[model samples]
Each structure stands twice: as structure tokens, then as C-alpha cells.
Target: MNFKNNKILSALLLLTLTYTTGCYKDKSNDGLTPINTVQITDPLTAGTVTVFQGDVLRLKPTLTLSMTEKMDKLEFSWLVYNSNGQISLASPRAVISNQYELNYLIQGEPFILGEPYIVRLAVKDTETGVISYINYKVSIGNKYGTGWLVLEDKAGNGDLSFIFPDSTVEHQIYSSRNTAPLVGPKKLELTPFVITDGISDVGKRLYILAETGSQEYNYLTMVKKFDYGFEFYIAPTIQKPTVMTWLSTTSGSTRSANIGIVINNGKAHSNLVGGFPGTKKWGDIALTPQGTTNYSLAPYAVGGPGVAAMIYDNTSKRFYNIIAFSNTPGAGSLTAFPAIANTPGQFDLNNVGKTMIFQDSSDVVHTYNSVMKGDDNLPYLYRYKTANTSTATPNLSISNIQMNAPGILNYTAAASSTNTGHIYYSNANVISRYEVGSNSIVETYTFPAGENVTAIKYAKYNFNDKEAVKRARLVVGTWNGTEGKLYYFALSQTGSIGSYTKQFTGFGKIVDLAYKY
Candidate 1:
């Protein structure tokens, strides 16, 4: 009666308690309470929605349930994890809402691109205490990337900086923009606007041409992230790279022509960088030279696309057709042209109108008696239109034109984007415009009285659009040894000087202003 009765009583009590409360949860309202299941009904599914850091994420998600009334008892929470799937405490969570702002680089954590984060939304049912989760992988892209990349040369030392539209300038960004510091201490030149395999926003590349190290002549040679100057695009190792240009990379395009480029370092040593397909790396262009001799180039325009360039040998002192020197794929070479006669012994050459517009020894004149006095050396321009290499021999008939009076000041000139007929030339403290067929200046812009004009280069190629109606901005450099500045200007729709636009200052001296497109 003691052992058997006690054991039987214990078993009967255990069965009765188990029936009263299923497992440990009370089942008194089991028949009255509802049974249901919930699922995320928006944002498609996992890996469906994509977002970038510091962007607005709108999630107006609804719930699909076995029964609809349970929606009222649902509670939602948001959670974000780092690329490593570690819960990022910095990522804040909010109640289910239509808009949620995401910030991956919050406070202590700075932006680390290519680091993917997973965002999960947890929705729980208060009645059942059941939870459902929907996940999304957020990737950082180059959306917040646009600006001007300025190249500076302190004495012989070279560095890079970035100036965004918001006026925030990142100085010496080369050190951080790439995995390695931009070739430094002796930056020879900056070649911006090299196209890359990546998309345009972040994929565009810039070459920080460095001075040859340990006596190597190849300048900086570090390919950089155009958006952030310091970021290196790839391993920095190139041979005597001079300049680059970009044309259509895809094969068999129906467009009118390819914007091919020709690069030359002195005796026309060549290196090209452009695309042949959408996935190719952004480096040396694809060139099938006519022969080994054709591998190099003569003097070619830096960003001149589909434009003819005159090849005047520094050693020969004689002007030759560019074709007589280098041959670029999809680009015609210079055809033979009559040798120039009685040309100035000294000249400055800037490719204007896709031809040679030279500033002679401030002396040569048109009249026969002009030589008796001496070279006027005024703002006179001698333009020679080199023929299309695929068509005919270049003509030597010169268009002897005059601009403002030229002095001993450093003068630099570049063609306008409006039309080849328009040109810009910078003097001591002035920027003057001239029309090819006109004998007088079309317009002139004088800098702040004493600011000296340092260099002139064409910028903002395809400024607003990349179509037939291309726009260009002229970047003029000026400095007083310690502080340097650049003045931006736009050409009128009709090729006239439009206005004095933006001014960027803060530098030792601007060695160059290559457009980062």
C-alpha cells in the first residue's frame, strides 16, 4: 500500500497536470485563442533589395499571414550586421516604418567600401511570441562620388587633392585613396580621366605620374581612384607613361567614330589606356600597330579625340604629319603635307581646331617689309590645318592671324568646345578669345590685375552631356608661388567666352589640371 499506492498516485497526478497545462504553457484558452503563421510580404525576398550606405531605405512592407487579424498584434524590429556578420551596435533599429535612414560609417566606424552588410527585419507576434525575419544585403557603391581632382607639384614633389561640388577639399588624398600612397616626393604629372572596368562613378581612373625612382624615369605611375585622390586603382608599375585618352571601347559600334587616343613620351614612345569591352581592366589601350616602327607616336594631343595633330620633330625642327609618326587604332595618321617655309625659329604649339595654331617667335609678320624691323612677336597666330590622314596631303598654306599684343609673358592656348573655330589663349594676366577667320580678338577676360596666368587646359569634356552637343570648361591656373588657384569658365553656345564662373584656390602651385570627367 505504501510503495505501489505512492507510485500510482504520482503517475495519476502527472497525467492530470500534463492534460491541464500542455508542456509548461497554460492551455486554458487553447480553444478561444487563434492559431496562425506570419511571413514578410514585401521587399520581394532575401537578396532582393539593394542599398548603399548613407542612403534612404524605404521599406513599406506588409505581412502575409494564415489569418489576417493577427497583423494587429505584430511587433517589428530592425537589425544590421557588419560585413563579417557581427551585429553592428552602431546600426540603429527602429519600429516598422516606411522610411529608415542607414549609416554604415556612423561615428567611430568610417567608410570601408566593398564591405557588405546584412540588414534583417524581425517581426514578432505578441500573442504567439512567434518571430519572422526578412534579410537584405547592402553594398556600398560609388554613388556619392563626383568632383574635381587637382594635381599639385611642390617644387619637384607631386601630390593630389580632391574638391567636391560641396566645396569640401580632401588634401593629399592620394595617401588614402589607394591601397598604397600615390607615387610621391617627385610627382612628374597627373593624367586624369582614364576609363576603367568599373562603372563611371567609381571606375574612372587617374594616373599619378611619378618621377622615376632610384633613377627610374617613369613618373609616379600610380593609378588612382579619381573620386578619392589617394586611393590606388591597381598595382603602380608602368613604363615611361606619358598621357592617355578614351574612345568607345565596345567593338562594332554604330556611332560615327571612335574616340581613340595617341600617347607619346619624347621620340613618341607610346602607352595607351582605354576599353575594348565592358569588363576589361582600365589600362594600356588595345593597339594592333601596323608594325614595330608604328608602335610609337609623334607629338599628339593629350585629350584630342578624332582630331588631327601635327608631328613637328624637336630634333628636325620640321613639322611632319602626325601619321608620319604614330598610328592609333581606329585613328587616321597624318598624311604628307608641304613643308612649312620661313616659319619662326621658336614657337609654342597648342592643338587648336585639330590643327597646329602656333605662337611664333613674337616676330614673324605677313608683309615682305615685316622682317626688316624684327619679329613682331605680338599675339599673332599661324594656323595650319593638317588634312585628314585618311584623305589627302596636308596643306602648308598658313592662316596668319593676329590676337592681342604678345609680350614676354608665358602664354598658353587651348581650343574651345563650342566649335573648332573658337580658341582661348592666356597671357600675363589675361585670357583672350579669338576666332579663326577674324583678325581681332572676340573677347578677353582679365584676371585680378596682378594674378599671372600659369597654364591653360580644357576641362569638363562633354560637360553636361556626352552627346553631339558637347560642352567644355576651361581651367586656368594662377599662383604667387605659395598659393595657387584655378579659374573655371564656360564657352557660349556659339563658341564665345561666356563668363567668369568658379575659382578654386589653396595650393603651392598647380602643375596641371587634368579633367577627371
Candidate 2:
């Protein structure tokens, strides 16, 4: 019990007392479990992410901790710092949890294309007084330009012209019928022209056939650029001159423009010494050595009244024709004939007595048979017969492939020998294509919901590995209140139709399209 003994006993007694009462309970790490740190899983980096103008961006956090951990008092605060560096937390608050996702739409004012923005997310533990924060940079842009010029119309005396990516403008060819006025001023007038192989011949001359006022006006129009400036011509009373080809025939005594080898009313007829009387009888004008004129029918004559002709066959040595008409007995009645005869070979005597002349590539004539009738009371196909025979037969024929939907307004068909024959047409809101040979209708494309399509064209363009002469493309023009827009669809090689990677918007209403390559 001396001084040294007393000090040692005091230290021993202190240790014994600490052990018995468990002083280590207050020293162990056990209070609020240190809040197992919060983190944002998405937007892991501090750089920019891009999204469309009206789309949404999601923000999420990755949490890792025991479920027994207290999370009821956790709170989240989202703050957005715009491009101008103004901070605002006007958005609603969220609770932090292990299995929750938060989405934020980066929308407010109209987002300027190609601009950068910043967003921030913060999580706090109210119980422990701890906070965590994260930030991200984002950008917005519109990559697609406008679309192609599908349909073109002229108003207020403006001469319509179209330029390609190279900035070369090709003036539309105006024909004589287009020059004449059918209705008085203030008529909602329009002239439609087709550009053959426009993609290949981007800046070259284009062939166009447009009606001046109505079928009564009947202008077979052709416009092209020769050595001089642009030149145009018009003939009267021709039906839709869908396709044109150049041919050679013996020069005859006809005063009609000397383009030889003319076919009319499904019959091949050369011009007599003088041109067919009146402008009404003039068929499609073919490019001739002298100039562009109606095809010549030497000995035979155009039989029916409506002289509508479309190209049927083309070869290096000769060409064939298909003429659509009505056989009903009347002044404007039409009678279709399918016959085969050698062209520019026989005139005067050899060709004089022949009627309904149509020939195929093998120089064989196809007899026209009464097959079908259209809504206009015209026989879609008349019985096929040889030049002098009247036996109904069917050797080579054309069939009408009906469209899928019925609301088609302004419809047109263009074909390329490269692929199966396909037709494209447009209604008020959508664009479509059909495979004629396969008899399959495909609603291959659609524009923005409320767009109105004016015209559609299919031309041959080279892309990928194949020489695509029959690639289906569409040029659509639409208006959103103030400005007109144009869109182009570059269909896939397999002829799958949709929007192309390229587009051109913000232009006037396109009235016509013509291309020469």
C-alpha cells in the first residue's frame, strides 16, 4: 500500500472497469452507416451527348449498399444550367433509391441546332447532412436538309427552273400546246413534265410533255436546249404522250414535220405529203433531222379518233408502239388495235391496206383483243389481230395492275427495263410504289403526317455495284403554312422505298421536273 503500489492498483482498476462496462460500443463505426455514397450511372462522362430536337434524355443513378441501410431520408435535386450559365431548379424533386430511374426531357424554348447545353444532378442525405453532385454536356443538331422537288407548278408568269447539287439549272422545254391558253386568267393552271434519267444527266437537257389547258388544248410539248438557247414546240389534241423514241423511215411526200416512223391509234402510219390536217391529229413530236415533228405514217392512217400513243418497244434497228382508244361508235370513240408490221420498209402499196399495226422486237405483230375497259368507257385492250386478219388472239399483251389504295388523285407510272416494271403514285398525304410483274403493292414511303404530294418520278441512276436503270425515287413537295418544302426518296437497290439520306427543304412549289444526262 506504498505510493508505487497504490499507482499500479489505480491503473489496473481503471482497465477492469472499462472492460466490464463495454466502452468499445461507442467507439465502433455504427451510427448512420456512412450513407453508402450515391452516384449517376448514365452520363458517366463530363462531355456532350447529342439528341434530336424534340426527344428526351434519361438520367439514372447506380446505388450499391445493404437494403437495411436507411434511405427514407435521401433526397435528389436536379438543376439545369443553360448555354448562358443561368442556374435554375424549377423542376420537381425526386427521392433517391436503389431501383429508381429519373427521366428529363431537354426541352423548353426552340433548341438552336448545333448548340451545347449542360445539366446537373445532386443527391443529398437529410439525416446525415451529406451531398453528391454530377454534371453533363449535350449538343443538338438537324442533319437532314430539305427534300427533293417532287412536283413543280408555275404561277404569276415565273419561268420555272431547277438546279442540282452542282448548281446547274436546266430550263423546262415548253411545247406549243403549253403556249396556248385554254382557260381565262386566274385559272388554277398547272403544267407537268417528266425528266427522263434525271439523276445521271443532272444538268443536261430534259424532255417534258405537258398539257396546256385541257385535252382539248392538246399540246404535245417538247423543250430542249440546242445550239441556241432553249427551244420549245406544241402540237394540238394529243393524249398523254408518256414515252418518246427516235426512229428512221423513208422520206415521204408528207408536209408534216419529217420525223419518220410515226405510230397513231395503235397503228403505225407515216405522214402523207402534207402533214395530217389540223393540229388535232398531231401525235407526239419526235426529234428529226429537220427538227422535232410528228412521226410519219406513210401509207396506213391513224384509224381511231383519240390519237393517244405510248412507246411499246425499242431496238437499235426498229421501234414498236401501243395506242389506247375506245371502240364504241361516236365522234370521240376509240378502237385499239394490236398488229405487227415492218416499219419504213413498205409504203404506198405494201402498207396502204394494213390496219392496227403493232410489232414486237422479233418483228412479230401482236394482235389486239378486247380484254378490259377503263372508267372512261374505253377498252383497255382490244382483241389482237394480224394486219389483215380479224381472229381474236393474245400473243404479247399489257395488263392493268390495279393500285392498292383507292384515294389516288394525280398518279403517274415510269418504268426501266433494268428492274421489274414498277409504278409510283401519290395521294394527298403519302407516296407509294408497286411492282407490276410481281403484282405486289407496297406502301413504301410516307412523309410528315400532313404533307401533300404533288408528283412522283422514277429514273435510272448508277449506285452500289449494279447499273440501276429502274431505281424508284420520289420527289415530294409539301407546305407548312408559310414556306414550301421538297423531299427526295432514294430507294434501296432492292427497291425498298423510304427517305433518302439527303433532303432539300425550303423552296417554292415545284411545278415540273426534266433531266437529260
Candidate 3:
């Protein structure tokens, strides 16, 4: 009996030892494991967020783990610091989370503009108390808004030119009113450049065209201003003694800037092939569609070639150019090329001379084909559909004004088309409106006497000012013989023209205008 009892005790002991060993093995393999490491992948270290003040900014966070572990069990913590050195885990302007991704938004408070803020994100492992963190920087500023003006010194002269929503301001030479002298105007010898309205996804920028001359040669200069100012130039192979008109076209992410100079070959064909001298070379000044790069070049277009003008069609997302040539005539015979086309004869020949080109919202190119003489001669506005270039079509015909009229000599036309209607222009002095549906010049707004009407452009003027609403407003720079004065006019809808309310005037003549932020 004693031997049997001892055997049972030994068997029980063996069973307990086996159970203990198995428990130890299981704990070693799977229990009480420390998190190997934690990593934050996105919102990468020092990533940047660009947003306007008073806007909601969302910050997304991404994370990675040493193991393919589920994120549901993880805990998240976030912190943000302003330039002021204040600390906050939660901001009315921003939100944070512990998920694989974090999102933050700006609050309604008036935060500083053009300032940068800092943010920190962290993910904690609930099981092992492991945490991974990331830091980032963000900038705040205003997005592009309406109701603005731009000015440029195109002539590189000391004169200041400006473009407002309602008016074009041309400072007269030797006028007593010139107040603000542009930077480096006298040194640059900038004179008689071009100004155009530039639009981007975020907003618009004003471009000033000028020429800078060195002791040896001359080059075309392009100046632009937004948050900051930028200037660049292109060199032409040939030299001419006359003034040149700079033309530009933008389509999608592409842009082309060219100059038209009369070719002075001392021959009759010289007038036809190159009436405009110094416009021997074309330059590609392409801009990124997103407004990221200041300026860049894209591909070029090919065709029989002529003069080119561009208009952006928000609805179509394309740019159309009016290409006319000295050798090519007839409506359909003059082909319309997309700014991005990749074919030969899609662009004008190197020396084919053209007068004026314009584009509307429908991607149709309107060209003033008649060549005029002298700085005072103006061209007629003609229409050419993108699909049909064989026959010249009259879109907005002005009958009262004769080509090269005495006072209207050397006049240039500006045009703008919107869903509401179309505005056709002759210099800054006369503006004619046409309802798009009817395509007729329904109304004319002429500047008052002493307004320097010939300096006006439609796209550069402000139409939203209080005075502009009742009557169109224009930026006028006048010369009273002794000094040049800059004025902004608020005209009455219909009546005798009135004196302009001066905005800024002093010593410089207002030559051109541009809008900038």
C-alpha cells in the first residue's frame, strides 16, 4: 500500500512540472513584448503648409510602425506653436488626432498674414509605451482676391505707369503732377514698354514690358510683381531704331512672349515682311499653370506664322492666338493654331510681319490685320474663329471712326469678353460695349477732354469702383506742361465728361499700368 501511494505522488509532481514549463515557454514567445520602435512617415519632418490667414488649415499625419500592427489600438497627441512662442494642444484654428493620418484646420481668428507656424505630431503605442513624433512648418497668407491695381515702368524711364480695375493711368512727360518715381527708372532708361493683365489659379499679376540698353546692345525686359517683384530679359539678334510692341499668349501651363519690330531692310518687301524693326527673335516665357514657378519656357507652335495674341477661356481651358502674316490672307486660309500645337507652319515664319492680335473667352482669335504707319497709326479689330480662318469675319465693327483718324492715329484696341457682354476698346480714350449675343457695339464711353483718352486699355481699367459702376473709371496721367499728374477718373454713365479725381500726381508721366498683389 505504501509503494502505490509513493508512485501516485511522483506522477502528480511530474504533471505539475510539465505545466510550469509550458507556461514559461508561452510567456517567452508572446507576452510582455516591448514595442520595437515607432516611426512617423508623413507630415514629413519640416513639411510646409501654405494657407491664407483666417482660413482653416488641415494637416494630415501619416505614421509607420516597426511591426504591421493595427492603428486602432494606438493613441495620438499633437501640439502647435505660433511664431509668438505660445503653446497649445488644441487650437480653434486646428484639429489633431492619433490615427495613421492627422488633420488640422485654421480657425476663424485673424492670424498674422505671411507668417509661418510650427506643428508637432506624435503617435504612442498603448501596449509598450513607445512614441514616434514629427515636426512641420506652415505659412499663412491671403489668397488671390479681386479689386486691385498694378503699375509698371515699361519705358524704363523714370515715369510710373499703373493699371487699375477701372482705369489706366499714364503719367505725362514733363508734367508738374508727377509724385511717385519708379525705382531705377532713370538708370534703366526704360521707355515705351507694354503692360498686360496676367491671371493665375491663385490670382493675377501685372507684367511690365521694357527695354534695357547697355553700351553695346539692347534687350527686352519683363517685370512682374506680386508678393515680390521679378525682372528678366530676352536678347534679340537684330537691332532696330524704332519702338517695338511686346505680345504674349498663355494656354494651360504654357506662355509665349514675342516682340514685333518693323524689319528695316531698306526695301519694299521690308515693309511687308518686317514693318516692325527689332522683332527678329521670339522668346518663350512659359508659366506653370499652378503658379508655382515664377516663369518657365514650354514648347513652341508652328504654322505659316504671323502676329499672335492670347485669351484664356475658363470654360474651355485653352488659349487661342490670332496669327496673321504679311503673305497669308483670306479667312480660312489663315490657320488658327492652339498655343500648344506641335506642328510646323503652326507658327509664323521668323520674319512674317503682323499688326495686332487679340483673343476672347471662347478661344477665338481677333486680329487687327491692317498695317498702319508711324507710332500713331492704329489697326482695325477683326475676328477669326479658331476653326475658320479662311474669311475675315466682323465681330465688332466700328463704322464712325476711320482708320488712322487724326486724333485717333496710332490707336490700339483692347477687348474683354465675359458672360454678360463684350467691351471693345480704342486706346484708353474710347470704349465700346457689345452684348455677346448680338455682337454689336451697343454703347460707347469716351473719356472727357484733358483725360488723355488715347492712353486707355480696357482690361487694365477698374470697373468695380463706385464711380466705375455708375460710369467707367479710368487711370489718367496728364501733363500740364510743367509737371505730369496722375488721376483716377470716375465718369458719369452718359453726359459731358468731368474732371478726373487725382489719385497720385507729381513729376513723372504715367505711361502704362499693371495689377499686382
Best candidate per TM-score, number? 1
Model 2 lDDT on a 0 to 1 scale: 0.37
423, model 2: CA deviation in Å?
Answer: 1.7
Q: What TM-score do all the candidates reach, one by one?
A: 0.51, 0.35, 0.35
Q: For model 2, how does the per-residue alpha-carbon lDDT over 97-198 read when each residue is reduced to its tens digit?
A: 232354644343434445556555666767667777666676774321111112244442323334454433334322221454222111111112221221
Top model number, lDDT: 1
Residue 468 CA error for candidate 1 (Å)?
Answer: 16
- 1 versus 3: better lDDT goes to: 1
Model 2's TM-score against the true structure? 0.35
lDDT (tens digit, per residue) of candidate 3 on 231-336: 1123333322122223433332233333222111110001111323432232222222332223211111211123343222222223333342344442112122
**What global local distance difference test value does model 1 have?**
0.45
Provide the overall lDDT of each model, using Cα atoms, as 2-decimal numbers: 0.45, 0.37, 0.37
